[model samples]
Target: TPTTIPYVYAAEEDRCAPRHDVLIPSRMRFTGSTSFSVNVFNISLAGFACDALLQIHRGTRCWLTLPGLGALEASVVHHNNEGLGCAFENMLNPAVLDRYVAHYPVPETEELEA
Candidate 1:
């Protein structure tokens, strides 16, 4: 029988605000550089996690352009094979974040039906 290893979250996880999983298509640009399209996997009032192909290192600052919300400044805190985690310079309003997440878009095909 194969044994499974339990996943352990980092100590920093305790300091983070509650996060909500959402698939919001967005763009990210390194400070003073061209923007690259990326997918925001999850978000919270504090910050967001995105999947990007660029080699963004920890402590790098960037801007995230969310679908409904405008650009917001953030700093990279960590990165792994999956993607990078960032912390917002200014926290987002909880109400606004909830609204956006609740109404996150559906595929065009699905939208057409509704």
Candidate 2:
């Protein structure tokens, strides 16, 4: 098993799962409803953050569809100007996460020495 680094959250609600920042495109839909395009910004074995301007209630059941994968069941955790944050009903596999990170990596600042 790959080791995961824990990220500290707000004092009130803390999250420990390792979070990988990416820009993977996806589709989202409320339970048994229609789906729309979304972009996943950050993902983990536990949850993911997207650019979906969800005006739904927190804890609303929803499904997230990623390319090469079927609908993944999750629920609305929160939403802000940054977009919607959701938690998966079942923890995602680490290997699966590795694939996404391999494709879309967190942007890094580059310094050139000339």
Report clash pairs, candidate 2. Answer: none
Q: Which residue pairs overlap in candidate 1's backbone?
A: none
Tens digits of per-residue lDDT for model 2, 1-114:
976532212210556478877878899999767899999988988889998875878778899998899999887878898898888877788899899989976556411211
| Model 1 lDDT per residue over 26-79, tens place | 889897899888888778877777887556676688999987778898888778
For model 2, the local distance difference test gives: 0.79
Cα-based lDDT for every prediction: 0.75, 0.79
Indicate which candidate wins on TM-score: 2
